[model samples]
Target: MSKLDKTNEHEEHTPSSSFSREIEKEPGGADIQHCIQCGMCTASCMVASVTEKYRPRKLIQKILLGMREEVLTSELPWLCMTCRQCEERCQEDVSLAEIFHAVRNIAAREGYIPVGVQKVVDTVMEDGWMLKDGYSDFIEDDRDDLGLHTDLGWNNEFVKKIKKRFIDGGNKK
Candidate 1:
């Protein structure tokens, strides 16, 4: 191969370190540099098996390649199930859950949250949790079919204290 051609190929594949560095600063993402791309994480990832777009190894590659905007702006980071299957099988002991969580934190702080994630956050902020406020109609029917009690013995005082400590504290009006 010509010298010019070789130089061009080298320039094209140069490793961009900024994004990886930024991720390393987050709480659980410090272990990202240890990943060896051995594919064990991918092989053990339940999300990767079912979803064509949610490959954990590929996500790490993106960050390592300094694809900062692409990593933060995409819905791919939000697809982690946090099952820790990949972490368990990792050769490098990298915590995929922590990395994903850190990515999600960055994404949220950057206002890049997907619609479904925003809805869950809104639910948690408003109701102190998701299921309690959403478990009336369809959930009750399922519970009845299974011979379970449909009446929700909810604790309003607990909810009130949580709202005071967090939800109410945040609101200006």
Candidate 2:
């Protein structure tokens, strides 16, 4: 093999054990002791299987090593679908999905919520709904569609009752 070819081969085969150690220092870091390094989480992760750089196993390694800069800022962190497939497949019950959430939460607290996710959060905060469109768009006349009685006055009464119950339950806010 040529010199360049040899370098490429080394890069492809070398495991990132050093980086894995840095990740372990992170808050709510993945339990490295629990990981068998069996690659089951990576095998089951939809994000990892599709994106070579976003492997859950690698992420756990990163967390173990305290690689906060790389772990928090990487697009790979946000790419997780939070499907819990890795969690389900792990014989160790490592809760990779929860680990992903913790990482994402840390990123968000540090002002790293991706623009796409930030936009969704903004919409929900402003509209009290996931979609940005007006409430009229969601409200419907059909009883089945509304999931309640079609009578508008009855609906108002129902809402009042709910509000009263909430207040009585000390949920005034």
Candidate 3:
């Protein structure tokens, strides 16, 4: 047998494991095995419409093929907007948005968070909101000055608790 022929034979015979099974082992990955690659999810995806790199259909295919590492490391998981449109459109009723969120959390726990996401997380940790210095800094007027009837309050304790519960818990919510 020739070397090229042997290599081809081995490649053709490799058994594919279920990447969906691995992801579904996690919290938000339920129903991932139901995906049937109907392309409806991708067709309705706002991110996919604007960017060629983000495609829910393709992501499902990669997962079904057991490309766990590639799916987790690539920006594909982060591109989802969690709109649930894909889930609604899915013929198999797969929760694509939830699955994406679950995968993103896993990636973050593995220290694979993108720089932009890290910055937002740091901001949330520092302040009660995701914006740095809080939203008050962006506005020039106080509640009283703006003639607002209600008063705005900042609870540092609440922010601390959230950090301890979420971020410190390895981004597991």
Model 1: residues with Cα > 4 Å off, grouped in runs = 1-16, 129-133, 136-173
lDDT by residue for model 3 (5-110), tens: 5432322112335666767787877667666567999999999999998888888778778887898888788878889887766666678888888888888888
lDDT of 1 by residue, 26-51 (tens): 98887787776778888888888998
TM-score of 1: 0.69
Q: Write the per-residue lDDT of candidate 2 for residues 49-138, one digit (tens) a residue.
A: 676877888777676556778888876778878798887777666667666777787788788777888888896664344642222313
Candidates' C-alpha lDDT: 0.78, 0.62, 0.71
Enumerate clash totals for all models, in the order shown: 0, 14, 0
Q: Candidate 1: lDDT over CA atoms?
A: 0.78
Question: lDDT of model 3 at residue 106?
Answer: 82
Residue 8 deviation, candidate 3, in Å? 38
Worst 10 residues of 3 by lDDT: 7-16
How many clashes would you count in candidate 1?
Answer: 0
Using Cα atoms with residue i matched to residue i, what is each candidate's TM-score against the true structure?
0.69, 0.58, 0.69
Best to worst by lDDT, what's the order? Answer: 1, 3, 2
- Candidate 2: regions farther than 4 A off: 1-32, 132-173
Task: In angstroms, give how far residue 62 of model 1 lies from its true place.
Answer: 0.4
Error of 1 at 111 (Å): 0.8
Q: What does the lDDT read for residue 101 in candidate 2?
A: 70
